[model samples]
Target: MNTSLPPVEAAPTGPDAPPPGAAPTAPAKVPMAELFITFLIIGATSFGGGVVAYLRNALVLQKGWLDEERFLSALEISQALPGLNATNMAIIVGDRLRGVVGSVVAFLGITLPGATLVMVLGVLYASNAKNPYVNAALIGVGAAAVGMLTAVTFQIGRKQFGKWIDVAIILVTVTLINYLHVSLIWVLLTVGPVAVFIYRPSQLEPPSVPPKQETVP
Candidate 1:
């Protein structure tokens, strides 16, 4: 007689889990008008490059349109590609929610508010270009923007900072950019690949759903 270990069933995966060959499930269909309104709010309110913060709060916290993991995944994809992060995010999120039309609505909704405001502000600034008060106001706005950016960065990267590797990467990137005056191109080319390789699919473990508790016999 031979003894063998019992066959082990794999743990259930979350939304991304479908069988290896099966297509991943589609995103829930959202009403076009509602989607447009959501992004419009983000576009109008988010200022001084604080769009990402507004986006996180709107998409994840307020709307529940995307969970934390999915939002971060989308953010990662957006940042990796070209163009502005704000617009890139709009395209990805919109496409995920409603395909091509969703993408268009999101892009327009997020951009239109800022574009219109910029047109008006540009005209105003052109007239008041040398006004001392205007310059002071602009300086204040810049400082606020910096604070917002820093806050959002901490919020998003808080968990990742638990990893020493992540902390090291961040410090290195900052030192290179802020202290060494290395170009962004050099930083991305060098740090980007290392980060990717470290977090590559082969090395990382998938999130596992807890097994159901069994009842007493």
Candidate 2:
């Protein structure tokens, strides 16, 4: 994983550091130009498997652009969608930042630079894939991608498995998917709402108790 992160614990300030509210505040409206540039940077540099983890750390933790609850909501929706995780993430994050415009900016930002780079690499590989050195390099890159993905799994798992019920749901879901080889749509349709009902942080809280009165002699 990339080690470059700004200090998360630093005192908050600026437009990005608004006070907490019942609903999380939207990010300051940045120009489409700026949004595109920021995501372009993320797309260009975020290598291997941990891209989503890197994105969460970068946007939510280090940048303080999103609170934890909101971030998790977006992540859940993104994972449920049938598409490339990173691309889905871009849409979610962008939509949060600036609604439809932000989503378009983020999508373009994530796709353009990386697509160009990959295209170039693909052309080169098409010519040189048979070469020992090129093949070895591709294999190394593939391994790095897997390593990054594993890191993302660990990070997301930590966030998702907040309660014992969450663990149970995860175990059950994994078993159904891996052992039974059940279709994902069915697994999600079954588990998604159940997990939402069972592990909802709101439902798990203790009810407020009234203060006790003093006893008369």
Candidate 3:
């Protein structure tokens, strides 16, 4: 008399099982065309040199393409290297999303609009160099550019402004460049090393003191 029920199978474990309480990661593959279009929009619309802010807003906040930490990490790499921040960011983010094709498309998208606009402006400027109206417009544009630059500088440096060391470095650098008329090369060679040393890991360590000796009876 076989009365025993069939044994129930346990759920599969190991590689087949998703880890308990772990979140699913976002997809890695973004479309190349999407990358190009995103940068194209940024290039055409971003003005006043606030492209970094625009980038953060679009990629991190609007699109969810990158988290804040990841965006900042990429920005740091871009800033450390020699190139326009916008293009550098385009290449890094594009490569991260889709590889070589992504990089090429992003670079073209970010640059093409600006390049075309610049060429048109150059032609117009050359033709109307002595026109009073054009001269007035250029002056107005320059003033606006200065204001934008100052605003962007302070916005980017807000965190650093709270720190004394950063403020000191900034002041010294400004004095050297503006007041002393130091050559850019010499300033970089000297101030760069000093600033690096000031913030080095070794300088962050707390000094070790010998333990107090026991008193004799």
Candidate 4:
């Protein structure tokens, strides 16, 4: 008899449930202490740039506080903002779940651990800048970060890959950043609006021609 529970799925819904991407009408709130502990754990354990991966696992897969669609929505909002993605996500999801107080609690929880670790690591690196073991560890961490980011990118964009327009957008964005060396500001200012227009409602919907006149029976 195994004592462990099964892993939770990303979205748990039955036939009658709302469509997959719909945001839940009301999010179930957790205790403030619990919320803080959750983000704190994520902040401490998530290495490199993979905080978003940890966030998705904790918030959607484990906590069930947010559905997969809602998690993605929050992630997009965080990316558009001016701060670190992990902190921005903390604020957005915290507000949704626990209001102003929750946001404060979450922000502190997520930042405090990283802040402390950075200070300590900075001191250690200053003293042992050329230590082979330390250098090797950093390189390993970088590799893991790249792998995490790649997996998450593919998971998030799997649907878009099939759409030529979306694929074009991805390619263009990468080309601009990698080959053309376009400033990120310019890329966002130009590509963002074009992408929006391409997917706008009017472009997606067929023109509303008047219904063909029906012959009276």
The candidate scoring highest on lDDT is: 4
Alpha-carbon deviation at 109 in model 2, angstroms: 1.4
Candidate 2 lDDT, 20-100, residue by residue in tens: 332345554444666677788888888655577777877777656678887788888877778877888889888878789
Predicted structure 1: lDDT: 0.84
Q: List the residue pairs that clash in candidate 4.
A: none
What TM-score, to 2 decimals, does candidate 4 have? Answer: 0.64
Name the best candidate (by TM-score).
3
Give the distance in Å from residue 91's predicted Cα in candidate 1 to where it truly belongs. Answer: 1.8
Which pairs clash in model 3? none
Number of backbone collisions per candidate: 0, 3, 0, 0
Evaluate model 2: give its lDDT. Answer: 0.77
> If ranked by lDDT, best first, what sequence of candidates would result?
4, 1, 3, 2
What is the C-alpha lDDT profile of model 3 across 1-217, one tens digit per residue? 5654222212233345444324326443455667788999999989766789989988887767787888999999999877889999999988887788888998899888999999999999999999999999999999988888899889889998999999999999999999999998999999999988897888876657787788896
Q: Candidate 2: where is the Cα deviation over 4 Å?
A: 1-29, 48-89, 92-99, 159-163, 200-203, 206-217
In angstroms, the error of model 2 at 121 is 2.1
lDDT by residue for model 4 (90-187), tens = 99999988899889989998999989989999999999999999999999989988888899788879999989999999999999999999999999
User: After aligning candidate 4 to the native by TM-score, how far in Å is the CA of 126 from where it should be?
Assistant: 2.0
Question: What TM-score does each of the candidates earn?
Answer: 0.65, 0.58, 0.75, 0.64
